[model samples]
Target chain A: MAGLGQTLGRAATWPLTLAARAVDPPLRAWQRRTGTGGMAAVFLAPNLLIFSVFVLVPLVLNFAYSMTGGTGILLGQRPFVGAEQYARLLECQDYTRPITCREDQFWTAVGNTAQFVIFQVSLMVVVSLITALILNRDIRGRSFFRAVFFFPVLLSPVVVGLIWRWILQRQGLLNLIMVKLGLEPEVWLNDRVYAFAATIGVSTWAHMGFYTLILLAGLQAIPRDLYEAAEMDATPPGRVFWRITLPLLGPNLAVVLVLALIRGVQIFDEAYVLTGGGPGTSTLYLTQYIYESGFASLLREPGLAAAASILMGAVLVVLTLIQLWLSRRAEGRKAR
Target chain B: MGRIVLDGITKSFGATQVIHGIDLEIEEGELAVFVGPSGCGKSTLLRLIAGLDRPTSGRIEINGRDVTRASAADRGLAMVFQSYALYPHMTVRQNLSFGLENTRMPKPEIAERIDEAGRMLEIGELMERRPTQLSGGQRQRVAIGRAIVRNPTAFLLDEPLSNLDAELRGTMRAELARLHARLATTMVYVTHDQVEAMTLADKIVVLRGGRIEQVDTPLGLYNRPQNLFVAGFIGAPNMNFFRVRATGGQAELPGGLSLAVPGEGEVTVGIRPQGLHLATGDGPALEVVIRLVEALGAETVVHADAADGTPVVTVLSGQPSLAAGQPIRLAFDADAVHFFGADGMRLEA
Candidate 1:
């Protein structure tokens, strides 16, 4: 009976060992795939889902709503109006009003936004590049200076607007300083020109630091030996900076330009807080126009607001594509 | 061509002095090599000559002009670095023409110079290729070609062949010697390889501990070393030193074994390994126990220990019959042996 039991035990163990070997590889492979896949899904799913609901869904619904005349909440009761809003936009008149009325406000906002983006983004990028170059040098107390420059980027845009508004007020810091010096006190933020200037100044001061830090990183990544070799070859310092440093920094410069352009185009908080699209809408932006059409003031045309937002998104996408194409071409040249 | 002169060149970083009051002169068209172990200031001295670094004190005269305060570009010299230091973004043609371009040379002249340097280096087919696409030897040739186009007063090379593999290093060494001969320009090369110093230099400057130990031709350094350091440094397997006591014009080795000395006083007897032979009969001999034997077909080196446990190596050609733990007698010609005093300076007989 003992011998029979040993034989049965051996018979069972053989099949069990073969089964374990057969299952091991596929099971481990599945475990590895699921482990990485699950971790990736955990990190990416929340942002993807939130963006789809908040950004993508609203974008699609806004395009559909722009083709219709909406008087109620989105996805609720509304009537399809068939391009009437666009026609009204082009005719420079209110469709619902009785007689002919000028609609110069919309066109004025577009021009102001364009001017602001052009002036503000260019000035901000140039200032940031200069600051980054200075900080990249081997100077003492560099980290301290870097922090001091970058402090403004961390502030809320609303707070920045409020702070500048106080500084530019009629009897505010500028006038007070001027009176102390026994000079004539000028009306600072009251006129359209001064208001636009104040808007550009505040935006530049708040955003230049972030771009400076990014460009500094790019500058530091360049090897110092290249400069040494250039010097040995009798290449002058100016030529080294222009030929070697600038061309190598093309990718970083492109990033700063595109980011500044996008932020400049979508500028809303400072203009809304300081100007409220006022002084004849000199500092008004496209976003403020969309907002005033949707909820603020007496215009409650959600379809027009949706159409403007869609148009803004399309412009941003096209601009980003052009920036990407430029970066790729620069990389191709380097490869050659 | 210019005769380079360094007068009282001293360099200090904070408190530590690296190159201490070095003075030397290189006649025009001489291929001089500065060779030493690491941190011996050979590379620093080269940089000083190239005007890449300023001397803490003294003047550098190139062809009888003081260039101590001149910038590297104004000094009119070219250098090849160990890392090759090629501009990765530029093709071979652009790299060769960049220096000329910066000096505002005409476009046609730049093109002509590029073509000439490419053909001279035998890299005409690689002119359009970037540095990353070339092999190590090709890149090195391009680097040399870059230096050649400038027509500088001197060429400074800092271990330019150290980056190549063994086989390519030999080939490049021959090519560099050929290049120097063809160009006939003042060239100062720095290396730590004794063999390279022996083969390529018209004058070898041996350095030790941030100072010049000896400066002479290759055969001069090998045959008549000034000190024990040079004797040990210049030869392969090194000269063996055995401590001896002088009495009555005879030198006594350890363990009471004795040999005749032509002079008096205590001296360290130095003998090159190739000078030693296995005596077939009675001769001036010392008994040694063989520890290890290496056979290389042409020669066999026997590593052995003396009766007093002093280690010694005797190299013999045409394979002697020897084995470990065997007792053997080694003899060397008296004319081939060198004698040094207790202060490590050579003593002439």
Candidate 2:
């Protein structure tokens, strides 16, 4: 039948958007009345609806859960003990020394997360910048090198963590090489500092490729004439890098920094899978602490876990605000 | 001391050679221009002199010092690029001083040079602002100011005014000429706009397809272009060409008219638009059908077609007595005529 063919033909077109076709008339009328911004909003309605349901609802519910007590999954059955879970997280005598805190596990996770973020973020920035600079040059087989640099970013975090875990174990490849070179093998995972270092290195290895890709794009966007002008001025290569390359790459670097900051604060999978909060909790991180307290606990204190996550979010928000301020100042300088 | 000599400089990227070996001498205090259409490698030749690129086979000497292998910085030359290439992050003042400061010059001396360049370029008020804050003309001045602060042996400019609007480009071109007069420094400039070369250069190097078409004074190139390519390229409205049969230094035109040349062969006749006289009563004249008349304020240009459909352009002062779809016979002297042979090479008188 012609009708069946029409329906099948319509269904075959991508994004196979039958719903969009149905709404097209009113959307066009609205666009005619209000212009581009209004039509853009109409196009964005479905995404906004999905985000409100999936992300916003859970965020509000978690805040609600943090103010409650007991094992009840439903909010109506739970008894409210407002601020008690928050107070538990804040019960630190000497905030700098996590061991002195009443909630030692919470403070230990914060301390560990801070150490990991600092080490990982700095290493990530330097390593990615170096890789991006090398890859951006006129080296032979540059596309192949770019793919090689960006390969690990496409990998799953669990796969990345497990692979590193095996390699950093007592009888790993690194130690095997060390032993073959007449050096003693290191007990990498059993030691606290070694385990912490392992986590930072693995996380950097997993994420540096993404940042390198970002920085490489930034490098490409720079006009070649600027470099030529610098060469004309006889600017030394090192000074040119410091003066021209780094300053121009400011916005991309800021994006990498903020994303790394949020990811570091919210990191769980790599450290969790590799260390399992082992070596006397030296590798414990914020998300793993929240995960252990919520579902892995004997009593299953969901409220405590919610409080910890909210605290982590707050720290990330503050860090992001500072980054924005710094980048804005930098952008202002660039304009002048 | 600013004399730069290139002996057999050649450049190639992979298998395709962009610059055939070229030998040239830029005299001290000369404002030399390299002008050609796009892909002519004028900029590449400039880059070779600037030492931003190396020659495949040649020796380059500045003031008799062999600098074929010297880096751009080592060559003590400064360049103003087409994009202006002002450090966007630095203020105008900082841009001028950046190069000087790199050589470990005293801070006070660097400031003195910046002040001098700022005053010379009339950008003193723009010192505190960044490149983005300034207009195109202002950025161009800042770029020039940056070059002046270096006080290098010679200055290289690569189409520094092409980015501006037409009127601004005119102003900048004049300013650049005046700057050269005041500084008396050897300057090598590259541009695709022959007008810029004609108006600015003491010596013009016309190039085509990575080879030098001719090197002469601006009038020397315009009055007597060495070849058909230079004749076509050196004019604004382009030279008019008419196919002609020739024997024994005489050529036959489409309307049974004949022209005398210096040589014998099958040839093409060329005439500048302004070369033809449009007087009602004159000597020998070729009939042309008037197609269109453009009445520009200072001058009027007539576009017409010959009987055989070869396009012809003639320029007259003010408005000329002509109408569309009317036939007019134009007269020109035998001296103004240019003849090219079957090989596309010009026949010199």
Candidate 3:
């Protein structure tokens, strides 16, 4: 009777064991699939979350805000107004009118921002490239000079603006120096033209160091053996710089140009602190215009601000695309 | 044709001296090799001649012009580096034509020269490919072709074949000889390989410890090494040495065996492995116990220990069957023996 009981126990456990083995293949396959899936999701989740909150959601909300009434009410209470805010912004007349349809302040601000971007970005790139070249040379005290040049980049933009404002003030360091040197004191920041130039100069001074460091790093990464070989080939130093170093540094220069352009297009802090977009708004930037329309001014036309923001975003995207296309073309040429 | 005259060339890196006042003349259209161990200043001397580095106190004259301070390009020379140093981004055609382009050579002339060099190097099919696309041997050919298109006064080759494998090195060696013959321009080659030095050099300069030990034709350096260093360095399976003392016009070996002294000194007796013969019955015989026998198809090397356990190598031509641990007697030719003093300088017979 005990032998028969043992036989029955074995017979019953065999099916359970077979069922366990039968479940293993699918379980393993599922585990493998989920493992890869989980790893990929782990890697991508942070970037996706950040992009959704910061970029995608903001872009969608911006478009939504552009199509709504001036007040930033919630979705349920908001009234839809299609394209009217854009029309009003393009045709606004008086500065005090809440939504003037004939004013030119927005366009004037746009023109001023364009001019600032054109001048500041070009000056910044040239200055940074020159500084990078100087710092790249095998001169004594290179590290010290590099630190000195890059120190301005560490300052906050607002602080940099205030420092430059004080320097360019009518009774400030520049006028004081001029008076002490037996020259007439000039109004540097109070005049409209001078204020515009000061804004650009201050912005360039604060930002040139960052680009200089980047360009210097790029220049230093180039192998010294290439230069030695170039010298052996009898190529002049000027030609070597132009043909070899510049072409090889094309990617780095492209990065600098794109960064400077984007920063120039979005300039706001220096204008706000140094000039207050003032001296007749000569140094008013696009971002300042957007800020004034959205929150700073008495009438907060969030819809017009959202439209302007969308336009600026479009311009930035277009500019970035053009840079990307140019980089691709350069890479294609190298591949050939 | 260009001859290099290095006069009192001295170079120092801060406190350490590299080339200590080397004075030599390289004949025009001759392939001269600087053969030395590593850190012996052989490459440094070549760089000095190429004007890549300026000597602290010296003059380098190429084709009778003082170019000690001239740049490498101004010196009218092209170099093939050990690393090959091909521009990774440029095609073979571009690499060969770049220097010419810098000198404002005409487009058609540059093309012609490129084609000529490509044909000469048999790299015509690889002209459009980048250096990264070529094999090691093919890249080496392109490097050589790049130097050839320069039409410079002299060619400075710094261990050009050190990168190739053994079989490819042999082939490239023959190719280099042919290239030199065709060009017939002066060539200064540097290498640590004695075989390369022996086979390729019309004149060889043996350097040690940053000083020239001897400079002579390959056979001259082989047959007439000035010191023990040169003797050991110039030959494969180097000459064997036995410590001995000279007394009463006879050299007393350490084992109490006496042999006639061609010269007198407390000396190191030197005999080439090939110079020793197996004694049959009646000769100046020394009892030896065989340690190892290496049988090559053409010659058999018998490594043995002398009566007093001094290591001796005996090379026997035409197969002589010899076994390990066998007792034998060996004799060395009297004329083939070399005697060096306690100072390691050779004593003239």
Candidate 4:
């Protein structure tokens, strides 16, 4: 029986072998002509071509669009107003009050995004760390709990928004439970404060699983014997966490922090779907405002939207640079 | 005083029991070594005594107080792991003082203890360095320093020297002896190397298959092992066993060699390699064909087979003229012969 299986396996792989043999000579000739560095470029050509078309071209075009004026989407139809859109966006009597700004909605979106990033990133990191620590223990149903926590990460952002919208809507599960408990059932999405808090909570729930998984892996890599030695030394539980667990988890925590910050700054899809920037623009984040200015509103100004997006992109780039710096510092310390 | 007593200790992981019932007492200031092969539960027994692991059914007493159900921290014992287990991010000084800091010890006293440990272990110069920057021997010293700064009830070392290179292991072994003498603290050390057990142990426990085979002093074990497993395990190159039939007080070897022993019926005879010598003239000697010869500077080791194919190893003194395939006569003194009964237990005269 084993002999027959081996013969069948060999027969199944014969075409693969023959195809490799047929392509080998041409590949070898190409390598000989190109050298190793040139061959590497050849192998990377496909990915580089796709990235250029999808990322680089749009970036350059966005920059060009940001310097133009009028409702016209095409560059040739619009007159270049170099830096006027930026000047208009920054023309505010008082930086704190959006009512004094020319682009009041944009200022409001900026305020909302800053608030969201602060609350959501901190909440995400703390919740994910707690979940990871619990899951890392030798408890029963640990794997089941880990998978449950990670289930939201696998769902589409639209699906996550819709699910939370169902739970917190006036006629949804939360209101139903509140009404059953003889309490005044409130319209959660219609209240400014509740809606803003709901957006942060839903976004954190949707993305925290990825961060938790990263922390779980880091927690596992710490050697078990270190904890045993600490126990032998009669270290208090709190000191063990602060001195041993926290210090050792430094690199992973930095990564989670920066990642959560970036993800929080970019929080648009779930909030947009759930709140639709309602409750007097209380949850109208930067990305949603850009979407409304560029394409969704009847009086759409593509140039203003492009300028706002360029500004947002700059913020993201700075954030990404900070993340890179932190990780490099961490790696450098480890190397030393 | 750091005296530990284990009464009816047994440990099992689910359905599989790793340590059988064991009873032992380690006196104050005694260095007891547990020696065995892998999977022999020597380390498990040490961990059980250390309070790092609780036995399935047993009572452990430290200094006349029951600590069987106590937490490892509550038991106040220190352990040095095989991997050193030094905190990577902390300096050697911080590693030494971390436990003391948790106990709310005064800052000055913590510093004093750290300094004293550093001086005692000769690691004062390396205190500012991280564990990764230190060499293996230096990391081992820091590990010991961490344990010593605690001044716990006793010390439990689980194969601590097994990770060191051979030459460093010898140096660390001598250093450990000196440390034990200076501290006068009870210590339970686990290792599979009998040489380490023989040289450093005030009392040695031999284990096999999670059961204690014998417990005695190093010389007592070497001179008089309790069973065949111990008789072979205690010596390097292993003691050779010969199957023979005994009638009255005389036993007959497979190669027609006859010997007087203290057993009747089926008997097994054990002889150490150093116990055999090259025969000079006619005597009660066995003839063997030399298969291999290893000549050290002071002594020569010969691997030979008897006429009926019983393998024998003899360590002969001086560079005697020997080669493979050469027939030789090996003689043994009767006092060096160990007789075992059918059950593998040592037979007493």
Candidate 5:
């Protein structure tokens, strides 16, 4: 029986073997002429082609659109206006009051985004770190808890927004629970402070799982013996965390911080769905401003939206460069 | 002051029991070495004593105080790990002082301890450098230094020298012996290397399958192992065993060879490779054909097959003229011969 099976297997693989033999000669010749670097380029060609078409072309077109004027969707139909759109966005009388600027709504969005970034990014880091530390322990149902925490990250941003809206809306579950608890319920999405705070909370809840996953991997990579050594030293629990656990988790924290910073600046989808830049523009972020200006509003200003997007992209680019540098330094340290 | 006593210690991880019930005592200022093969629970036993792991059912007493339920910090023990386990972010000085600082020791005392450990370990030049910057030997030194500056009641070392190369291991072994002498603290060390156990231990505990096989001085274990397991495990190149039929103080070996040994019925005899020599004028000796010879300048080891096709090995003092397929008679002194009964227990002389 084994002999028959072997014969059948050999028969099935013969054509593939023949094809490989036929290609081997030409591949060897190509390798000999091009060397390893050329082979690397050949392997990278497909990925580079897709990246250029989807990313590079869009970036170039965005920049071109940012420099043009008029309400035309097509670049050729618009007139070159140089930095007029940029100047309009930057023009302000007091620099603090959005009402003094030519693009008051854009200024309000910038102010709101800055506030959200500061509060939401700090909260995300702390929450994610605590969650990662807890999940890294040998607690019962640990994998189940990790999956539950990360379930939100798998959902679409719109879905996440809709889920939270159902809970936080007036006469919703939260209000019903509050009333049952003998507390008066307020309109959560109407109050300016509550609306802004809700947006930050919803966004953090949606994305914190990814950062926690990064941190959990970092925690696991730390050698178990180091913790054992610390225990042997009779070091206190708090000091062990400060002296060993936190320091060892530094590289991971840096990555999480930069990534959370960029994610905070790009906070739009979940927040936009939850608040709709409501309560008199209390939760309008940078991305929502760009969307409203470019495609949503009655007077569509494509040039202004592109300029704002370009500015946001610059911030993201700077953040990505910092992340790259941090990761490189971490790799170098590990190599040493 | 660092006398430790364990009463009925056992450890189980979930359903699997890694360490069976054990009772041991380590005296003050003695270096006790636990030598065994992998998965023998030697390291697990050390961790239990250090309070890094809790026993499943046992009582641990240190200096007459029960510390089985105490946290590792309260146990006042220091440990050196196999991988050195030095905090990679900290400098050598900081590594040595970390424990002292945790104790809220005065800064001047901390500095003094750090300086002393640095000088003692010869790591003063690398004080400002992190562990990653040091060689394996230097990292091991820092790890030991980290343990030393703690000045705890006892020290636990879990295969600390296993990471070093053979040459560095030799040098570090001597250094560790010197360090123990200077400190004069109780230390419980675990290693799979019998040579390390023989050279450095004041008392050696041979363990197998999480059970203690023998506990004795290095020479005691070598000269008289309690059972077949210790007899085989305590020596290099292993002790040679041969089955023989014995009656009335005479054991008849294979190939018409007989020896004066006292055991009834089936008996097993063991001889060290060093015990065997070329039969000068053989009345009754085992005849063997040489299969391989390993010469190491000072001594030579010969591998041969006996007349009954049993493999035999003998170590000679000087290089002897040996070749494959050469027939020779091998003899051992009667006193060097060890006899075991059918149950694998050593027979009392």
Candidate 6:
């Protein structure tokens, strides 16, 4: 057996040894001349080039488009407006009241997006946290229940929106159940407030599974010994939750809050699919407005859409910075 | 005022029964240690007492109150875990006072208790520092301090020193013994380290396969172990065993040495390494070839094999003129020898 294994090992190494004999001298010569920094550059070249082409170029083009006017295909034919689109979006009288502002549709989109973000991210964080805590317990069929909660996240965003659109449409499954339970068969997707609320709920229902999975991972990372120690100390269950579990789950919760906020700010699919910005434009969030301006609606204002997108990107960058700062602070505090 | 009594305690996780039915009593202010090897149910028994785990079939009474179904909080017992499970986010002071605050203890008293425990454990300056800032020994001190701050009926420590380095473990072990000396509480400590058992326990309960092999004082267990497991487990370097068959007032070793042993039929002879001596004061001498020798400053350990290949160990005081592969004849005092029956029960010593 030993001889056979040795023979097999030698046979396996023959091609690799021949390859090494072919390439080893040049590699050694390169290493000797250029060293580790040059090697690292060689390794990093592909990813760096991909990023420059895909991400950096697009970002620079978006910013450049925000400054220019006209729908010309070539960059040379387009005229520079120098923040005129930004100025038009920002021309608000009584900024708190979107109805009183010029370009009130733009202000309405901003207002709706703000409300959607505040409501959606808060509800998403809270509901996901509660779900994570429940699934972390030793309930029967915990894995099955966890998979049930996380199944929606595995679906594509468009599929999620389409599924909810079917469920929440007039004379749909939800209204059918409500009517069977002796509730009024009111319009769900057309009514202004209900349409906005349905968008928030559907979006939350779709994205909650992902956030809950993250928080569950955080919950699992906590040492069971800490809870056992807390039990031995005679700490009340509430105090244990408030003192131990939440504090230890800080970093993951911050990630959830930031991701939810950024995602909420850019919510497009669920609202667009379920309500299509509604009978009165009540559920038209920022990304939908940008989409309509760029492609869908008759007001194909590419420059305005680019400006709105840049502002949305700014909001997302701020949210990300906050997450980084919070997690960094938590890490620093824990380091001692 | 802590006294615990266990009646027919047994614990099983699904089909694997880990703690067998056992009855034991721990008196007030006694420092008892349950000592055993890993998976021997020592920690399980400790958890049962602390109410961290439930016994499958039995009743437990703490301070003469039946707490068989009581929650861990209602049982009023404080436990220090093997990991020194401190709340990482809280300072040492808050870690100590969290339970007290949960009980709605007065502000002054909680502060006073934390201060006293901190000073008692010599961790007064460390009160403001989080547990992450503390070293292993310091964290152990804070864990013990957390238990002390609780001031419960008793303290349950589960391998508290197992996480520390050897030197720190020594320091913490001494500190723990001193803590017991001062508190005089009914403390039930569990550890797999026999040295900790020998040094810190007033009553050492040796367990094997979920059964209590013996329960005695440290010296009592040392001088006379109840069975082979206790004899093998209670000593450092371990007790040496050799097969022997007794005929009337004499026993014959497998290596062909005969000694005056008061037993009949086949039995196992147990002797400590320290019991073996040079052949000067002999009843019977057995020839041994040294296989290995470990020389410490104060004592030297000699590992050797008999003619028929049964292993023998001799621990000599100071340095002996011994080298590996050298043959030497060794003897022991008759009183220092032990005899065990075929069932592993201690027979005539």
Residues B168-236, candidate 4, lDDT per residue (tens digit)?
999999999999999999899999999999999999999998899999999999989889999999998
Better of 1 and 2 by lDDT: 2
TM-score attained by model 5? 0.94
lDDT by residue for model 1 (A1-336), tens: 999999999898999989989978876776588887766775688899999999888878888878778666564676888777666555655534413434455566667778899999989888998899899998999999999999999999999888877777888888899999999987877788988987888899999999998789878877775676799878877888788888778788888898889888898997678777777677878889888887785748888777777778888998889788877876776565
List candidate 6 segments past 4 Å from native.
A1-33, A329-336, B281-283
Query: Which of candidates 1 and 2 is the stronger one according to DockQ?
Result: 2
Ranking by TM-score: 5, 4, 6, 2, 1, 3
lDDT per residue for candidate 4 within A103-143, as digits (tens), equals 99999999999999999989999999999999999999998
Clashes of each: 0, 0, 6, 0, 1, 0
Error of 5 at B301 (Å): 1.3
Q: After superposition, how far is residue B117 of candidate 1 from its true place, in Å?
A: 2.4
Winner of 2 and 4 under TM-score:
4
lDDT of 4 at B313: 95
Alpha carbon lDDT at B329, candidate 1: 85
Supply candidate 4's per-residue lDDT for B301.
90
Tell me how far the alpha carbon of residue B27 in candidate 2 is from the true structure, in angstroms, after superposition: 1.1
| Model 4 stretches with alpha carbons more than 4 Å out | A1-25, A328-336
Worst 10 residues of 1 chain B by lDDT: B254-263
Candidate 5 chain B: 10-residue stretch with minimal lDDT: B253-262
DockQ per candidate, 2 decimals: 0.35, 0.63, 0.29, 0.66, 0.75, 0.66
Model 2 Cα displacement at B77 (Å)? 1.3
True contacts kept of each: 0.55, 0.78, 0.47, 0.82, 0.85, 0.82
Interface RMSD per candidate (angstroms): 2.5, 2.0, 2.9, 1.5, 1.1, 1.6
Compute the lDDT of residue A292 as modeled in candidate 1. 86
**Per-residue lDDT of B12 in model 4:** 98
Per-residue alpha-carbon lDDT of candidate 6 for residues A1-336, written as tens digits (9 for 90 to 100): 999999999999999999989978887777788999877876798999999999999899988988988876456777999999899889888888888776688889988999998988899999999999999999999999988988888888888888888888887888899999999887888888888888889889888989999999989988998998888767778888988999999888988998898889889976787888986889988888888887777656788788888988998899889988877876776555
Q: Output DockQ, candidate 2.
A: 0.63
